[model samples]
Target: MQENTGAGYPGDAGVTDDFALAGVPDAFQRLWTPHRMAYIKGGQHQFKNENDCPFCVGPGRTDEEALIVYRGRTCYVVLNLFPYNPGHLLVCPYRHIPDYTDLTLEETAEFADLTQTGMRVLRKVSNAAGFNLGMNQGVVGGAGISAHLHQHIVPRWGGDGNFFPIIAQTKAITQTLDEVRQQVADAWPGETDAE
Candidate 1:
């Protein structure tokens, strides 16, 4: 048996020169996002009913309060509270319908219109190189809020995917939601042709 020296390995004689952790060197710099704990703890996505849904309540609030980028007659564009990347937006119908096929003819038209407008605005504001646009259908399909049908508009840059997301399972968002919301809202076109 060896005595625990407290400063180093049990066999070492209080010599921690080689094992010091305080000054260890590494290539990565941490970007602490304590705000994400809420989302992780289910504060943001868990809703008991449609009345408590963020998408349903968002239309009643001010644009800034709800982080809304653009509003159409039947659909609207809002920033994802928990975004996969910066400038990520969601185009949703005002109605709290779960599936895409549930959309009315007018809602469907406006939904498509808003999605195109979202892509255009993202390109104009953030110079997005490409996009990942889709909807996760239900809980089994990776939809965090499956009760609301929202199409994601994720802006992709050339090298946005780095070692962090793959190795550490952490995505570093460069902009605050408020900042993104304001920029997207300000850059939104006054009118988009709806079909």
Candidate 2:
């Protein structure tokens, strides 16, 4: 006959084993950032109007302050404040418009040109393995700032997707926005004769 010791059993409060007392630590390290609360809350207040639109306001500020990588006549490229990746860029038209179809012929041309140039510059500077390029049309379509039209140029690398973003809801940005902006700006292609 055996006596009950409450060892290695479920709901056993009497377990005195060291392994049971102190659970095993995970091999992975965690980066806990409470500061992201500001970013989460700030999203609601960012696009109330054209004046409040970051795409609209970014061009007016200095290159360093605005994180502007390149400025075209009708469109410009700026670094995403909350980037999916370090070199994430946004190509936005100067005119405040909600839809892509609202762009004029000139705006459309410049927008397309800037988008391609942005990808090229990002590849040159960051050595990106791939890219996630597109526009989130409206609020329902995953656009954070749906009031203004902007195309996202997210640079992706091998093994860039990881459990941290999925489990912790936190993205680890390797470089500062300014550092990435400078790198891309420095590597941007010079204006061709056709421009």
Give me the candidate number with maximum TM-score.
Answer: 2
Candidate 2: lDDT of 61?
94
Error of 2 at 194 (Å): 8.6
Q: Candidate 1 lDDT, tens digit per residue, 82-153?
A: 788899999999888899999999999989988888899899889999999999887667676778899999
Q: After superposing candidate 1, which stretches have Cα over 4 Å from the reference?
A: 1-48, 192-195
Please provide, for model 2 over 101-120, each residue's C-alpha lDDT reduced to its tens digit, 9 standing for 90 to 100: 99999999999888888877
Residue pairs in clash, model 1: none
Give the clashing pairs for model 2. Answer: none
lDDT of 1: 0.84
Clashes of each: 0, 0
lDDT, candidate 1, at 177 = 92
**Error at 115, model 2, angstroms:** 1.0
